[model samples]
Target: MTDTLATAEIESTIRSLEDARYAAVVAGDIEGFAAFAHPELLYTHSNAAVDTLDSYLEKLRTGFYVYHRIDHPVHKIVVVGDTVLVSGEMRADITAGGVRKQLANSALAVWVRDGGRWLLLGYGPTVIPGAI
Candidate 1:
């Protein structure tokens, strides 16, 4: 395949994975979400709190973080070597630490190819101006 074709394929796969991951979160499927996560995943919230894979899973398992809805519109996907960077904006209704909130943020997700599969290595979101 040509380089362009290969990149497009990777982009498509990563996009699908992103969608599935968001769906898992909204559905409260810890295991499903875990399937896409790297062992050393670092998830950073817009509030600047960071969670390791274990902590994030625990929050999901215990309902400490409850995702009621998420609308993530990916703007770009860039492939470099075995890594993919996804850029997007996310708007969501969620409850964190027992407090309900709506969120609007610009998000970045990093996925790395490991052991012949793609796993999410890190994710971070920054609150959009005047959006919460």
Candidate 2:
């Protein structure tokens, strides 16, 4: 059975991984990106597109979506059983389908603990209602 309570230490790990994920995307580090994602990630974007882990990684690697830089602030992490949920604000410079796209977002990510390691199992990021 999975532990329902995550220690403050575990919570710290969660935050660090969140930082690392955005960093890896900006760096275009394929291995790092893959390491951060779980086998069955279901990600929904602010633009209303949805992807599984493989599809998402493929698009990133191919420049279908280019992540230039990312900043996450006001993030909160909570744990329930083996699942970790994160909610936050995101700002970034990005391109989608060869067009520069707005990047301000309100994001949520779900990470699952598997074999004692945390892997991002899902992501949903909604665009901020209005922007420059």
Candidate 3:
């Protein structure tokens, strides 16, 4: 396939996966979210707290982190061989550690092709100024 075509295909797949990920979080589907998560995933929150995949999942399962809704608008996607970098902004309504909050964040998500599937390797989100 041509480079352009390959890129398009990759972008589409990544976009779908991203959408599904958010949906899973909103729906409190831990297993669904886990399907896309890499074992060594590193997730850094807007508050600068970090979680590995296991910890993140545990939090989700225990209701320590609950997502009510998420609006994520992807700004860019760069495919570098088997790795993909996604730049986006996320606006979310969530409850973290029993405190409800609305968050607007500039988010970066890294996905890596593993075997025949793509897995979320890392994610970091920065709080947007005055967006709380």
Candidate 3 Cα lDDT to native: 0.97
Q: Is candidate 2 or candidate 3 better by lDDT?
A: 3
Q: Candidate 1: where is the Cα deviation over 4 Å?
A: none
TM-score of decoy 1: 0.98
Off by over 4 Å in 2: 1-6
lDDT: worst 10-residue window of model 2 = 1-10
Residues forming the 10-long window of minimal summed lDDT in candidate 3:
123-132
> Candidates' TM-scores?
0.98, 0.91, 0.98
State the lDDT of candidate 2 residue by residue for 95-115, as single tens digits: 989998658889999999998
Model 2 residue 37 lDDT? 91
Task: Output the TM-score of candidate 3.
Answer: 0.98
Model 3 lDDT per residue over 24-76, tens place: 99999999999999999999999899999999999999999999999999999
